[model samples]
Target: MRYRSSDEDSARWDGFPFREGDIIISTRSKSGTTWMQMICALLVFRSPDLPASLSELSPWVDWLIVPRDEVLARLEAQPHRRFIKTHTPLDGIPLDPRATYVVVARHPLDMAVSLFHHVDNLNRERMAELLGGPAPAAPSAPPRSIHDSLVTWINREVAPAEAMDSLPGVMWHLTDAWQRRHEPNVVLIHYADLVDDLNGEMRSLAAKLGIDVPEEQWPLLVDAAGFAQMRARAAQLAPDPVGILKDRNAFFHRGGSGAGRELLTDEEFTQYEKRAAQLAPNDLLAWLHR
Candidate 1:
């Protein structure tokens, strides 16, 4: 499966080195990838202030922007428990029983809305500058407003797992994880669950990743993973050291869900539901939007 969006090549995972107890945080784009990174950072470092920038610490294994060898060298030197990130679905990458996989999911509607802001804010020219390559041509005009953007995104549908950031793509990622949710090594988490109970989710994740923070330092770790804290440290947390966005904070935009739900009209929402039904299992969809 070729995930064309953002030019990410999932093939890079072919030769990934997975040590025992390695943690893989697999998620659809904008579905709390950075949030999970922060949680893992606190858990691994056992400190409120991270040793290095979160992005530098947890590089997307499949992202093509950085050379594969460079990414490998950085991870190879890390002494702490390695926590790798991938936007690809479970089937897209190697599945090692010795490694624990954490798949984070968000409401498809909300994810699309978040992705809209994310794609629109991308500074590709800056990215090219950093890569020492000619800037790509400008993108076509985008939808003028959030409402229009939602309408456009919700109506677009690709095959399940076809693109890690599309409507069906989100469902496929969730479905794959849902199927293996009961497995000891694969844990599924919802964005809503994390938002509703940050500390609770963090503890659950810590247990899954076999990370134990001293009882006295639990609060510090929890507080550091909070949305506001991550936003406050956006520059350090955001992966774009090359000024990939016009505003770094924009990458950490609204953390809430249902933005697309509110923007979608009755008829359009009906279409969305129909499409979602065709893609995801009934129970999985129930847990997702709830």
Candidate 2:
């Protein structure tokens, strides 16, 4: 996503303005944002009978394409318990005492790769068509694969951070939330753990949310929100003109863990590791390694 200056005219957010006891779903993109949204829905609603599609249930709060005020208005309009989504780091949010924030982390390697594919689907032409707004100019006719776009964005996004010997803003994002993981009102979940142990993570999530559904219902909730199942449902269930889908049914992409490393080069890997070690805390990097 392009980072427009915070001065851009619009509600961009007058501060998170969180209502008391509302749940806020926040994370960097592709770091299990949708997955955590689903988990929170299950916990809050306490049933598999999800009333609306994912968008209605949990709306994006900081989508630059939309006016920030419009995003907040949509979230505020929701009658159900609010669970708004954001990719901004915690420093970007309202951080009010009334909200419960859940931050989900994916291995940077996997996150980078997943983000690459995600950008590919929003190619300039596709973005204009899907977003109904001006699309970025296309690159000079090279056959740009998703990986290329992902890497380019990372490079462009990282230059400032690299110049400053920082891990780039995205790494700072994960570290900030990781540092706050122990707060009673904040929950930190590992995407790999969710992939490896869905049931256990769901239970842990429920416990954090102060929910306690019957034990037998756990499997049913997990199955209902399974990647394949959710993707299948989303084809029809998602709002019209679904944003950034390569195909209607392929939105979930691959849900496996550690995919980012497989696509990374030795050099990129070395740089990634060096930057991560320098910018992110040792314990956080160690957690991702685990």
Candidate 3:
């Protein structure tokens, strides 16, 4: 399926060259996309100090702001094992056996909370300029409170492919990946697991990706992938190559989870669980929310 938004078009994957051992970090916004990219970079390079910025090292291919030809050329010029990033789901992009698809799943509420801040952190005027459109006007009305926004986001109904960040959209992206979890080239990593055990997760992912890191360098690579560390280096790590983020450091706001669930009443939480059940299978929801 072709997935296109105002800012991205999955159809751009057409005629793209896929090299052996290419890694595609397919994830929804604020769902640990950059984190996985960092992990892949660390594993691929066997060092914490990358050759370039994270955004340059791993470009978002589907993003419309970057010219398709330029992005392709950049990827082509890279001599290292390419690890591309994308918000499009597994079903939306072509599945190449030679490439590994790493999909990160986060708790819906936590993802929603992070996304709320992410949208607020965006520089709309800069984005509009990058896309060759006129700058967007400042908001006339006050923005919705995070609590109110979370409630609305949970209840709003939309097709999964159409709104990949909505409740349904989150489920859609994960559901497709969950089904393909057993495939050799598809790997599923949970946000909570990474938070709970960064060291172990990084080691496990390295093993899965067939990367053999020397024992002496494990500590440095793992530390570099930590939330605090990433936030500290936000200028280099945050994915804002074109000055799209208002505050690059703000992009790493609240690396932990539960903020979204805290904003809801008991009834509201129950309602969210029920809505999630309707959208995704029982086992998938269990793993996702766990």
Candidate 4:
């Protein structure tokens, strides 16, 4: 497959050194990327208090702001099983046969709602300092209300799934992963499933990643990944020590589905459904939106 890089430097997956048994956590943004990262950290370290922050332990390789060589060196030095994070879909990546790829998803409406707040948290000035350039212009202020935010988010269309950050782009990201979910190397996870049964899901993920935790240690790993514990450790789990977020706690806001459901009108909900149908098959749509 032809690989492409995003302006944000997310496409730097090319030429990445992949060792056997490496785990690649690929998911659309706000679709439980940090959740899965924490899970991997817990499973690998088998402790609630990691030696380093989650982001430091499992860095997003394609994030250009961090410096590609620095990220590579950190991963290479790590002796534990490496699990990397990426926002790109399968097609945009190298698709190594020797490594395991775990793709996570969430209900689209809920994801949008979470992302709306996520955008608000971003500190463009800090990001620009990291990039060593003039800070990008600040984003327009958020809508006066969440209802207005959802309406604007759903109606946005910069390109037809051209950028992975757009509404259409998010659909295409899920569509690519859904298509290859049956492959031996690719495993699919849902945010709703985690919220429903985190312990069960963590065990299942352990099996998928070929990690065998001692039965006694299971509780520690599961407990550490729970919402409350993670939220308490937000400074460590949050990737924005650079002050990208206005509030660290807001990053973990309402980690369940249905926030968007309550905010949408019947007609707006129908429009979202129609758009989903256009982007994916019925089974995938049902699985995603559920």
Root-mean-square deviation of each candidate, in angstroms?
1.9, 3.9, 0.8, 2.1
lDDT of 2 at 146: 54
- For residues 51-70, what per-residue lDDT tens digits would candidate 4 score against the true structure? 88888888887676778888
| Model 1 misplaced stretches (Cα beyond 4 Å) | 1-6, 128-134, 138-142, 160-162
After superposing candidate 2 on the true structure, give the runs of residues whose Cα lies further than 4 Å from its correct spot.
Answer: 1-11, 67-70, 123-135, 144-167, 236-246, 265-268
lDDT per residue for candidate 3 within 1-290, as digits (tens), equals: 99988899999998879999999999999999999999899999998889999999999999999999999999999999999999999998999999999999999999999999999999898899899998888789998999999999999999987888999999999999999999999999999999999999999988888999999999999999999999999999999999999999999998898888899999999999999999999999988887
Question: Lowest lDDT 10-mer window, candidate 2?
Answer: 1-10
If the candidates were sorted by their lDDT against the true structure, best first, what order would they fall in? 3, 1, 4, 2
Candidate 1 lDDT by residue in tens digits, 13-89: 88888888888899998999999988888898999778888878888888878888988889999998888888888
Sorted on TM-score, best first, the list reads: 3, 1, 4, 2
Q: After superposition, how far is residue 58 of candidate 4 from its true place, in Å?
A: 0.4
Minimum summed lDDT over a 10-residue window in model 4 is located at 1-10
* Per-residue lDDT value at 57 in model 3: 95
**Each candidate's TM vs. the true structure?**
0.93, 0.83, 0.98, 0.93
lDDT of each: 0.84, 0.68, 0.94, 0.83
| Best-fitting candidate, scored by TM-score | 3
Tell me the tens digit of each residue's lDDT in model 2 across 1-290: 22333212213545657777687777766778888888788777777678877776776755555556666777777777777776666666667777888888888767767766665555355546544666667568976775665455445545422222123666777777888888888888888898888888998877777777887777788887678877777654332234555565555778888676676688876766776677678898899768
